[model samples]
Target: MRDTLDNLYTLDTLATFTPGVFYQFLMTKTQQFRFVKLGERFSSICGLPVAALLHDASLLFNCMTAEQRDELICDILHSSQHLTEFYGCIALTKPDGKQIWLEARSSPEAMPDGDIVWTGFVYDVTAREQALAQLAKSSELSRTILDNMLDSVVSINEQGIVIYANQTALSLFGYQAEELVGKNVSCLMGAHHASQHDQYLQHYANTKEQRIIGSNRVVQAKHKDNSLIPVELRICELDNAHGRSYLGVMRDLSHKLMQQQAIDQLTLQDALTALPNRTALNRRINQCIDNLALNPTQYCLICLDADDFKLINEGYGFEHGDEFLRQCARVLSDFGLYFLARTGEDEFAVLLETSEGRPSLEQQLGLIVQALAKPQQVFGDLISCNFTAGAFCFSTADFTYSDVVRSAELALHYAKSGGKGRIAFYDHRLDQHQRQHALLDQYLRTPDILSQFYLVYQPQYDVAGHLLGFEALMRWRHQEQAIAPDVFIPLAERNGAIFMLGKWLLQQACQFIRQAQKIPALAHCRVSLNISARQFASAHFTDEVLTEIRRSGITHSLLHLELTERLLLENPKDVVAKMQLLNRCGITFSLDDFGTGYSSLAYLKQLPLHELKIDKSFVRDLPVNSSDRSIVSAILLMAGGLDLEVIAEGVETELHRQSLQQLGCRRFQGYLYGQPMRAEHWLQH
Candidate 1:
């Protein structure tokens, strides 16, 4: 590090030069590097923008008990004396919870802004510590040093025969000291190197030049059990009065090698599901592409995602969300002889070998849906994981793996938007929506986007044509062009603008309800608002909602919080607790889009729910589709048993409403009553 520092600039210039250039130096050695200024608030560090930087407590530890960790934290964050400077080795716990040795130094300077700039250099000393610990076994020092070593040691005569064998060597090679006394030293190394040792020694004797005689290297060694073990060998050549001898030390690096391999795996494998991650998956696809030139095999890439999976993570907690991923991974891995990869939080890809005689892509998709469509039990909660698959069948026409993969991804969006558990196929003809993602991302960040956003209320009616209320739906218009919720919502969520948008939505909904109370026709009516899983998963979501409700002064029992069944499964106790807390405030809760998600009998009885809204997909073909009618009938019967009111959405025709009425559905929402309109238009109507 001093060498790198001197090569770059002098000590006097350190203040002027940015540390980002020096970061390349640290990356060559270790990845454990960070620097902070006092009053790190409202500032960026280490090339990280303010929005992307992790909090100090999160990067370090907030609840650490280790003395070294505590000491370091105190030195940097809460030092008593002005925290002038500190230079030493300390134990650093990485964000991944890995405890590693670190050699670090920090110099803090008090700035005019009442801030202290603490510039520091960090390096992981774990490998150095391990290497130092191995030096005793890796040197040709005194006998005391040899005896203290954990590795094996042996001495060989001019004839390449063993003259001395330490106890460690005897124990390691499964040979008795007496038996190995006159044996050839080549027995230790495997046959590959053993066969050439004598010739190499003779050549060295003739040439008087050394290749490996004084070097440290790793080689395959034969153990007494006839098993091959990786061992680090260091050799010292000695030429005494009579002839030449070699002092060789061997350290067992099997454990260290295994650790290195495990570390290597993290680059390409998912830590949560133990499946191949995006990098590995993309590599596999590239390999398949390369092989296609010769093999010409027919294959298809299916990119599938769990519908509304974000809600689980948001509603229950990240821990529960991880468990849900594990279950999904387990199910996907169960499929026969397919390359499965987790590409995103809820998205997965399967490279299936779909030749002529094999099962068709649709058949395979059906099997996957059938297997994963069942309710999963996570932390004693019944959660559903239904797959929406987008498939792209490839042939000789596809030149690159990205081409097919991108097409598959495009198809996946269609599948998700088409309906729950549906499949969308993307061929060469369909235009990819990938280009719009960046544009949408940029547009969402524009000022006055909130003003361009609006709410359209779709009215809900009872059996006697009495107005019950309306469901508030969000819409966005960009330059007079109406953008679908499916497009902009994902962009906002990804870029972290959703938090602001979510608060805005809640405020508007509450204010609408609060003001609607003054109108005689809408005074006693219920107004429903949709809540995003991401918004609800926040740490202070319930408090945020309650605060907005209070600020809006909506004290009447006119507000209803609508959520999907999958959302109800995440942190059920917490959800129920929050529901019960708000229920006391006259706010009602309803399970929205029912019959499309995983709903269990156990969770239903525990929720303080007022109604169940059957999804439009079930009610779309109610009069003609018997299958849809049967599903509606089953849902109505289940709601009837639980004493919950059932509302049918998308009742366009008179026959659709009549069918739902006969099925005992009391409330309706569709074009038959009224299409969604602006608040003023609907109010005037």
Candidate 2:
């Protein structure tokens, strides 16, 4: 029976033991048996006070297997710490995987064998281990949900102090979770928002309200490196048991701002030159005018228009023209302290600021003229084009910025009308006259003006007083009045009507050539027609002259083309080449107004010429002015040396002719012989 009881305890079979067996064992016991007090020591396993074992406990003398008793002893020894402290019985497993249990007095005492024992109960712990595994699974699931959340869950108190932050929040702020836990939310608000931040919080605290809660608002935040970054922040209030808190989610805005700035810059600037375009120019001008209004000092506005700019474009093509304009802009920028802008295709404007009550305006104007007069080389062509500028100075007594600009433009028109390469200051008289001239220029382009244009032949005679040839001079017989070539020629050039007018003159001259050929006396003489500078620059001029000659069926040698010295000087190489080509084709060239330009003996030698026409200015007082006499004498000597013919133009007096004839000038044309007259009149004479 003792062995069976030990086996039951060892096998954890206490519940399977029958109550009848316990009674039988108790009755069969030879010693007194009684319930001992519950185990006295506190139980480490059950966490309950040990009960004393009952008194008069029954002791059976029945023998048991040594293995069973050994098992009981092992359990007692294994659990001795708890058992000796008067706790319930405890069991343990040995390294061999053997199970054991112990039962003895609740308060075990040391026996003569020097061993301690305890009485208690034993049970298995497998069910408790299973319960612990279930708890761990639940805890892991809660942690996984918190870590994977997308929203930057930054927890802050009502005072805007950060308490807890998730991985998302830490990453957004460029910080670790531990670094941000105690930081104040205001630390991230940029300096620009620092002052207003307290008010915002105060308002929120007073009203229990939130401005950006659950909605996006632009805000600034500082990164871990202390750089300010723009962000779109969305805050949500959390109603947790831990009191009022806020969760913030921030989105960066650096990329959006960069894109917007790029678009703005591209829209405001010119892509080709990177200069401010018209839109930006207008804005800047307006701003400058506004600022100028405050001081009301002298401000000058000048407008520049390139002379014969169209010729350049037509000669070199538009691509070259564009490059030319860019180069011009770079050169123009060298002028100091001026607001220079390209206002039209070949027109530019400069706004100048002057000192108070200074009379240096004229000096400044001269400087500007000098700067513009400098030659520019474009596309391997040495271009010496000139500009006509019109200037207007602002006075509190007179005009606003707009009015000044308009006045300057009018003056520019006047300058161009007077003759190119000149500057005109704004004047009311000139402006009115310019308007009338503009109207006349418009009328001159009509067919009536074209048909009314006629030529008069000025008779040329040799020193022997025999008729040589007649120079055809263009005259415009306006229906209302007569206009001089000097006035209308420039107008025609300005309006680009010179091309057509020049062709008409050439054809008229050709007709005169045929008429002269029919006349017995003048048939042997060659007729000369003066070609304008504008005509020489025209692309189709050569073809037009050739066509007229062919239509007339007159010999090319009979038609002499006269060009002024100024025309040759304008583009010397081109002029020389063109004249050489025509000379090769049996046409003659006469250098008219020879002494009026920068005449070089070297150039004269190189030029293809048959005659040198002395300008009327020198010939008008030829025998009186020693300078004029010396020039005429020198020219005649030079022409003789070069084997070139000499024609004395503007021969208004008999002495003028006599003096020129004495100098060996063989040809002469002027009022002394006969004033320019119609071809019919020349035939009648």
Candidate 3:
């Protein structure tokens, strides 16, 4: 009995100091409320003494409102009948009028007397209750704001389950707000992205590494109809009551992307031809250059232009010219090359992936050139147009986009300038050739260019070592730089400057012939000068030669005009007419480089030619090469039958001279006799 009293005293001591009120109560079978026990702090918490509470538990109800009193009685009755736990939170006013919140939790037991006894505690939870009410109000406000936002907002749990989606998000994804609340976030994603989304979340959870969070990304979102919508999404990590979640704010990007693509198309295409323009070609070239490092492959850039396109513009109108260009673009497109673009007014550029090597590429290019030559329809007229192309091939990574384009353009220039309707390939040698051509073109355009030119005389001799005549060779000196006849003459002929230069050559040679006539021994010696195809083809050529000879007052028979076999290759009738006109006036004609070019006996027999000059190639090997010897013999025999004089050129040694004599050649012009020298030097010698 003493130990039991000691335990009761220990329990009373523990309850008095404990926070709030600890109590035990009961409801009798007769439905009478009674207090079993109450803590000393019940007075401090409920404004009632512990003994007063134990005597009548109704005294504790006095601290609560009338509603609280009724609720407490009903709970007591229900707990007695059901023997269930009793829990309640109620607002109370103390005797001093201090307002507070009280929370109670209790477990009831059925007594042997059919009464239910309760053991529980009630605590003042005013601060926590107020805070929770405020939080609920704030949450309602936040939800209202998110639902009305222009941008879609969504919240997902760490496991990627959609916990919350605002009205805008539901609309953007074509879903109702309730439909999206419990679904996995991947439902709004395409198959590929959906398959990997779980793995991405799992990786983030394991590593805490951020790949998409805290950064805005452009991604494709799937709508309810299975159509893809572009979206700009920003994901943020949110720490909430449910552990880590993600809040994604997204904006639709579909319209903006479409607008940008329209702008890019305008910037990268030709307005008239409807083909990719220079800017687009440049961009593609840069992309190719960038990829060359990763994948090494050959690239061939063909810069081509419609040959004689200006005639189309002149013959037809500019509108027709434009239509022709468009038609040309279509035909080139049909060739099915890698890339095509309009680079100039009548020019187009094609980029070829040259995996098939240069020969096959060339063959393909040849077919394109040929196909373009077949007539195309432009404004109801079947106009045939030809294309001249210049191509540059490269596999090295060191070339820039501009370098490749410029090289191809250089090849194009070479092709067009050489003669239209052909394809030219660019090489290192061609690069050097173009540089020289540009410099020569600049110099040749000068006003005083004729003053820079002069003639050298290479003596032509007989078998008796007597001077038969002199071949007047043209040379140029541009401020101490010597330009060879083979170099500047072709450039001059193509540029139409050969007319001026040819007139000067004729005047100079005629004057030399006049000077020779003053010397009795050299008076009969014929002076030979070369005639270019351009010069020979001139309508005024026959008159020009007759006028030069007449103005010189020298014997017309003493002047010999040298023609190449290339002249006979075209317009034989015109060539014969020009030769016959000059021959009738006592001027002679010799076929220069006879065996080296289009040697047709048909055209050879029709010409009024006096001599044939054996090109150095056939004479270089002399007796050493049997084929060359045989070729030289054949040429000599052919010349003999035609009653034409044969002069062996490039005779440098006694063996060469002796071999030509054995072949029945009487005349020769070579370094063995004398090299070409200035007119004054030859006169003094």
Candidate 4:
């Protein structure tokens, strides 16, 4: 008995220290339930006393809800009936509001006394359950993040079969989630790449070489509709417990590519005429030059300019002019030219293959000329579409694209000069003219260009040969060779060197007239300096002229500014204003080269003036040409009526003087009286 008592005490002490509660439950055949042995830890888990549970084993289930209590009873009854093991899990909240999960399992036995017994253990399983719940929540959060991304995400297994696809991936490839899950990833690739995918994977597996991993590339992806879509794909290799897999992130490049194509189209096309622009023409010429090596065919570059296109702008409006140009473009397009482009305002270029061996180049050129010269109705007016063209033919690739275009443009320039509405072909003389122009342009760019040039004075006299002042003529001597005024003057104006040249001329002429005060023959004489259209149009022209006159300390009345009829073609209001301002300051103005340009009595009456010079053309034939005599007579009569003085240029004989003298001409300037000479020689004369 003492040994039995000691054994029970030892078992009780072991049960008290164990991590779980040890218990014995019994169910009699009469449906009565009781706990024969209960551990003290039971009270700690269920918040009840072991003594109470011992009295009525039902108290052990009091902490559970009604549903849980019923389930526990059913489990116990089934175990008792079948003499099988019983297992159950239930959640309960103690009186102190501490919640816990308990798990119990027991083996059941049927006793000979018609009662069922269970020996079981109950454990607190709250920590393990909470950890499992947290893991599931974390997985759901990761899934949400992947599904909501902007870029498509896809994961494939080692066999290249898709194992996972995000919402973006499904939408990007136009596939449902289930439809793409187990399919080979190559199904979404083009045939070329699809056939090579497995090889890529096998190569990577064998050699561990990264051919495309961790890199971005643009590729074509097959859509569900069997159409190709451009996409930027990036891939990475992943290593996890599930073995090797690949992750691909793709971005759709369709919209971006379309926008780039649009921008490129705008770059090569003209907006107004809807034709290829200069850049496109240059590219076409380069292509022709490149192809010449293989085919050795002759090609011609024709540059065309619409003659008097500006008349449309001035007569109607710029809108009507634009319509006119568009019509011209349509007309040119109808000719089936090889390549056509709009090179500038009212300028078009064509590239033609001359080796077709048909109706010769001249015949083709004539056809084009006739077609363009036909009048077209524009905004209710029959406007002529007359165009002048210049062409250059070549069979070799010896010239650059710009060189060819420049040659054609040079021909066009000569054509326009010869007479508008004609076609001109390139020649060696045109090439020489271009070279000379280039050399003169280089000289004009020099800083000391003013030093290379000097001025000579041509004496102006009355009919009796009494001297009036002198006209300053600019002369340039380079390498002891004289360059004509018509050659370098236009070049200087084009290159913007005229500004510097004009200022220098004003200073030199002012200083000379100031120095001429010592000579009795020229003490009160006025020196006339011709002004270019560009110089006269300067915003600071008045200021520059006044500043030079003030610096020279010469009377403004002793300075005479000669202006060509071209000067009046610009903003006449500004011209009249400037002329009136200078005239108010005692500076005289004269219309040089009268009756040669588009000037009328309206410009003459509006502009503040003091004199008119008959151009040498109307005076060179003097007493012989009836038309020249009539024009000169009319000019003298008009100048007299306007209270203006007249100077006749290019007089070389007494007959010239006598004719002018009879026609009421007082001023005569030519070799007949005195020729252009150096200032020192003129002072001596």
Candidate 3 residues lying further than 4 Å off, grouped into runs, are: 1-226, 230-283, 292-398, 408-429
Worst 10 residues of 3 by lDDT: 132-141
lDDT of 1 by residue, 3-23 (tens): 333422432233233221111
Number of backbone-clashing residue pairs for each candidate, in the order shown? 1, 25, 1, 0
Cα lDDT of model 3 overall?
0.81
Clashing pairs in 1: 314-537
What do the candidate models score in CA lDDT, each in turn?
0.72, 0.66, 0.81, 0.82
Q: Model 3 reaches what TM-score against the true structure?
A: 0.53
Cα deviation of 85 in candidate 4 (Å)? 81
lDDT of 4 at 132: 29
Worst lDDT run of 10 residues, candidate 2, spans 18-27
lDDT of 3 by residue, 451-565 (tens): 9998999888999999999999899998899988888988998888899998999999999889888877788889999998999999999989888888889888998999988
lDDT comparison, 3 vs 4, better candidate: 4
Per residue, candidate 4 scores C-alpha lDDT tens digits across 253-358 of 6754543344334435677787987767877887888888788899999999989888889988998888888988998899998999988889999889878543
The prediction achieving the highest TM-score against the true structure is 4
Top candidate by lDDT: 4
Lowest summed lDDT window (length 10), candidate 4? 132-141
